[model samples]
Target: MKPAPFEYAAPKTIAEALDILGQNDLDEVKLMAGGQSLMPLLNMRLARPSLVLDLNHVEGLDGIREESSGLRVGAMTTKRVLEDSDLVRSQYPLLWESTVAIGHAPIRNRGTVGGSMVQADPASEYPAAALAFDMEFVVMSSAGERVIQAEDFFVTYLTTSIEPGEILTEIRIPRLPPGTGWGFQELARRHGDFAIVGALATVRVESGLCCDPRIVLFGAADRAIRVPAGEACLEGAPPSEASLTVMGDAVFDAVEDPLSDVHASAEYRRDLARVLSKRAMSEAMSRAS
Candidate 1:
């Protein structure tokens, strides 16, 4: 089925976009970036907004540049560019690896980073990467702009803290400290399908002991969730096989109610979480040393 008849607006500037959003209630308006996900919803008649704001023509929202904080990625920047960026590959290899797991080349060519984050899909890879890195989102509205930490941005399944009249403008990822090692792992039916379960890990080693370890899991909860218990298990501990197993178990146990659908059962998801967590932690440990 085709989307319900709706008005479309292409704003050349962010200010104009914000103005449009300010004029309409969120229930009546929808923002369109790559349209990889939104278009499907529209075509399915699941979303029937009165106005659709096309952000493709919006200026100053599609570039990547270096900043004192780390990398400043415009919300409209395509996933393909992110996967191929030299800076991301060299400095943020974990993010690059995670991006590669998103859909396929065709989808990545048009899918925007902001779209995936805002969509808040439980099976998406970007949210897991964002959680591991403590990424910050820059949100803008007519009132002005505000920075939101990744943890706070994602409120629940397909929900976020972004209010009406607000749009996600940028993503800021801090540089990983020296001795930090990272890993990303996911299981999918096919190379480009959404992950049945995904895990991302980052570990810092000092004096042969693990420190500042982060373990994030997706497709196991309402949103990307950090396994603090798992991370705590690694703190000050040697990154050995036994420790990795324990950490994975902690993560697996932390999942409250694993979502079960036609793709997999909750029991299967829990097992995947355990195994993937171990693999990710082990890879991170190997790189840390």
Candidate 2:
């Protein structure tokens, strides 16, 4: 199937793009980054926008830089770039792992970081990683720019807090503190396929006790979510089998409504959440300093 007729614009500058967006009805305008996600929808005629604003030509929208606070990643930066960055591999292993787990090399080469975040797929890895790392999203519009925390950014399946006229510009990832340990695990039908269930964890071990643990689960609900109940179960607890079991159970209980799809049943996803949570937490604890 081919996409329906639509007006196209390739803006070289963000200001130019914002101007075009401001002049049109936002609901009729669709933003395209790498076009990995949007193209499929367009081709299927699921999304028939009147105007397609392509951001590939927009400058300053693709790069990775280190800052005093953390890493500043441009919205158009590809997943493959993140996978190949030495800085990301060494310092942000969680992000690196998540990027690599997303599809194959060809998909990674064209899939943009911000595109995946904005696409807000429940089965995608980045959203779960965002929550685990407490990342911030920076969005812009003709009005101005604002930062949205990960907790507030994701609304539900294929939905986000971004306003109709806003474009996600950058993602801010806080530096993982020293002595922190991270683990990422997901179960897919195949290695490169979308995960049926996934879990991400970050923890710091202090005096043989888990400190400031974070557990996030994807492919188990409408949106990737941080399991505070699961985190609470591990906080200040020794990294013991018993503690992990409790954490796993808490994670299982927290997933009130697991998504049921052709890939898996709700019961299966809920169980995978329990098992993966324990495995991820155990791996994180083992790596903690």
Total backbone collisions for each predicted model = 0, 0
Candidate 2 C-alpha error for residue 211, in Å = 0.5
Per-model TM values vs. the true structure: 0.98, 0.99
lDDT by residue (tens digit), candidate 2, 175-220? 9889999889999998799999999998999998999999999999
- lDDT string, candidate 1, 1-289, tens digits: 9999999999999999988887777789999999999999999999999999999999999888888778999999999999889989988899899988999999999999999999999889998888888899999988899999998988888988888788999999888888888888999998899999999988988888998998889999889899899999999999888899888889888886889999999999999998998899888888985
Worst 10 residues of 1 by lDDT: 18-27
lDDT of 2 at 126: 97
| lDDT of model number 1 | 0.91
lDDT scores in order: 0.91, 0.94
* Model 2 lowest lDDT segment of ten: 254-263
Instruction: Tell me how far candidate 1 lies from the true structure as C-alpha RMSD in angstroms.
Output: 1.0
